[model samples]
Target: MSEEPPRRRTIRDVAKAAGVSISTASNALNGIGRTNPETREKVRRIAEQIGFRPNALARSLLTKRSHSIGIITNDTYGRLTLPMTAGVSEALVDHGVSAFLCATNNDPRLAQLHLEALLDKQVDGIIFTATRADLTPPIDLTRLAIPVVYAFAIGPPTAPTFIPDDAQGARLAVQHLLDRGYRRILHITGLEDYLAAQLRAETYRDLAGAELDVLFGEWTEEWGHEAVRLVMERGGDLPEAIFCGSDEIARGVIDALRDRGLKVPEDVAVVGFDNWRVIATQTRPPLTTIDMELKELGRRAGLAMLDLTRGLPVEPGITRLPCSLVVRRSCGA
Candidate 1:
């Protein structure tokens, strides 16, 4: 009762339409083997017009490259991994490559299994990603034969890694307040042990100097609310501004300020880190925060893996990308 779909176009069809030998067409399509530049362009144009897509399996067999990559992540919450994966996919798809994502959720056995499965699938390379920028895998990453890269994840010192510039992000938040003429600023952040927290606090201290009043606590709204109370009880001078380590913390701080009959940006300005839209955009006055540029990091990481697979040299070391400040009403600017 239903008509079948017409036949799918193939490389053979593309070759005939392009008026070239099959081998020549293949070379042109792949941009390899000394195909004439003009001919390559012509063939690509024809292929596009004709909607001719290459058979990945056959092409892989001929080129000895799987044309697929693997992403191994431990961020079960999808907060970081999802956006990064989206960026990675964008880069791969443009080059006609496919990617597979394996979520390990911090389970060691699952991580190992996914690693081995990716190897078995003959992925061109692997990218390790996680929620935490400082996450160091328990596995020995140095031994893998294929190209390995870390995106917001840690690997061996010699490996290529991409992470946000945490200290720089901190500076942006604190300086935004100072630029708004709030000289006395307080810093309230996550656990002291977290590398992100440590970097932010260190930068806050550097810029705030004598005006710095730092509070290290859990990365929770409860801690944020309590820190304000602690400051009040200590009889310390209330800060002109508060720089929060997270959007969640900023929300708590804003609420606490409201309870104390203070108006945000009028009585005190607040700046938050991790422009996580869910929390940042919902605050009473909205939040001015730092964006980690995580999606861009993923794109860079994907391209880096592609470079390694093609025998291009990638300088090995941690590449710290800059973070950007997002301004909103909360910062009074």
Candidate 2:
């Protein structure tokens, strides 16, 4: 038979080894009860030498805090949820908290099940995330007892939501093109129904005025290529720069421009949004784009959840964080 695993060392063992009462040992190890520096050090040393480890469950029971939070996402592809989850995990781990992740695949029933299970586990709080920035939670958030925060998605009117500032991102991209002396700039983007698309297009109009061309279509490379072909066929004064809605679209625009014997950033400059690494970096002249700062958004949501759990007041409603411009060869930056 395998030798019975050595019994795990306990506070009682440490107390005996340090020649102190159990209460004193507990106080010293936890830095409670105002133990003197010398006594605390001695108790800690004994505990360390004996490999004494506190029972987290027992400690949590006494403190009434599980030190854990649950994160729920309906993003089947993890395009947005992954980075946000990473940020939340990093922030929570710094505070000695653990995270539990559940992907609901956009199914309301599955989301409800996950939420109920997390509540049953007594998580301190919950964070709801999604693939789209403007998505609303499938389940009613107001009914939950624990605090809930929204990231890359919206909740009810009273819920706290975090999202990237799309208008500001648009402004940044346009301003960069303007700064580079590209007066004849064109906007090619995805479906107008999306809040992100609408916001970006509005910002472009606000800054560049009505005359600048705006094309609305799907968020695919095919749409990008088709739009470019249509523009070239129209045969007016060509745009000095093209601002695409996404990296994939930008890649299509660049390829189409190359096929027409136009040199990027010399005959025409180009920019894209989403900063999606694989597409952005691989473009002939790597695409300049706008970064949504999804990780920071997640970190902020994690901190907000912690604040709410601690009974700290936080402003409800959407908090829009600014997006940054990522410069690359596409825009001659």
Whose TM-score is greatest here?
Answer: 1
lDDT of 2 by residue, 1-333 (tens): 789989999888999999999999988876569899999999989887889888878767865778899999988777778888888987888666888999998788998999889888899999999877777677777788889899988777677899999999999999999999888889999988889999999999888777766899989999989999999888889999998988888999999999999989899999999988888999989999999999999999998988988799988999999999999999987
lDDT of 1 by residue, 1-333 (tens): 999987898888889999999889999998779998999999999999999988877788888899989898888888888888888887788887888998988888898999899999899998999877787774556788898999998777778999999999999998888777989899999988888888888899999985656798988899889988897788867889999999889999999999999899999999998889998999989999999998999999988988998899998999999999999999886
lDDT of each: 0.88, 0.89
Error of 2 at 122 (Å): 1.4
The Cα RMSD of model 1 versus the native structure comes to 1.8
- TM-score of each predicted structure versus truth: 0.94, 0.90
Note the residue pairs that clash in candidate 2.
none
Cα RMSD to the true fold for all candidates: 1.8, 2.6
Clashes of 2: 0
